[model samples]
Target: QKEVEQDPGPLSVPEGAIVSLNCTYSNSAFQYFMWYRQYSRKGPELLMYTYSSGNKEDGRFTAQVDKSSKYISLFIRDSQPSDSATYLCAMLLYGGATNKLIFGTGTLLAVQP
Candidate 1:
């Protein structure tokens, strides 16, 4: 099974709405977590990065991580049409010489006017 799993959402919402994206993992060794946003035909861009189990907010975006549950979430406030894109959740398992990065299948979000 994949270490991380996220809903491949074509999750649609109205502009100015609150949007929530989530992911779950089966691995307990993951120590680093991240969220990426990908526009159509473009590469994923790092949106949030954290190593601790807590909530981190940057402007309208908030990322929450819970190590005990192996769960992570990203929240977008005041969703915009410009925010329509694919969201990817990633985790890193760091070993002395074998750090591995795992990514989710990605959730697609669309904000409509």
Candidate 2:
């Protein structure tokens, strides 16, 4: 199985709707879980990072991690057109020398005007 897997969704929703993105991983050795948002061709910007199993909330974004199930999710509230972007979930190997991250394929989100 792939280390990380996510639906490459072109999920479209109305403005002000709630958006949910998710990812699943097969490795239990991953110690860091992160969510990144990318607009078009630009590089992804870190949205949230959780070191272990727990929930982290920032602004309208909430990140949830479940190490027992090896799953992670991101929730976006009060969604807007500006929030339309590709969301990527990433994980880093534990005790690795470098900070290399393994990424999911990404999900495309579009908030209608």
Candidate 3:
């Protein structure tokens, strides 16, 4: 199995719909989970970062990590067309300060008008 697995979703929804994105990893040594949002032709911007298992909330975004299950999820509440972007899930190994990131293939999300 790949170290990380995620569906490359081109998920389209109406404006204001809730969006859920998820990923699963096989590595247990990964300690940091991150979510990044990227628009066309642009590098990804960090949207969420969490160390270990738990949930973090910011504005309309929520990120959840379950180290035991090796799963991570991002929830976008009250989504908008402006929220349309490719979402990437990334992980970093423990005991690293260099911030080397291992990324999933990413899911493309589109919120229509």
Which portions of model 3 miss their true places by more than 4 Å? Answer: 95-99
Scored by Cα lDDT, where does model 2 land?
Answer: 0.93
For candidate 2, lDDT tens digit of each residue in 37-96?
999989999999998788999999999999999999999999999999999999988665
By TM-score, how accurate is candidate 3? 0.94
lDDT of 2 at 48: 93
Q: Comparing candidate 2 with candidate 3, which one achieves the higher lDDT? A: 2
- Write out the backbone clash pairs for model 3: none
- Candidate 2 residue pairs in clash (backbone atoms < 3 Å): none
* lDDT of model 2 at position 103: 98
The C-alpha TM-scores of every prediction are 0.95, 0.95, 0.94
Q: Comparing 1 and 2 by lDDT, which wins?
A: 1
Instruction: Assess candidate 1 and give its lDDT.
Output: 0.94
Local distance difference test, per candidate?
0.94, 0.93, 0.92
Q: In model 2, how large is the Cα lDDT of residue 61? A: 94
- Per-residue lDDT tens digits for candidate 3, residues 4-96, read 888789999999999999999998888789999999999999998999688999999999999889999999999999999999999886665
User: For candidate 1, lDDT tens digit of each residue in 29-103?
Assistant: 888999999999999999999899999999999999999888999999999999999999999889979988799
Predicted structure 1, TM vs. truth: 0.95
Name the regions of candidate 2 deviating beyond 4 angstroms. none
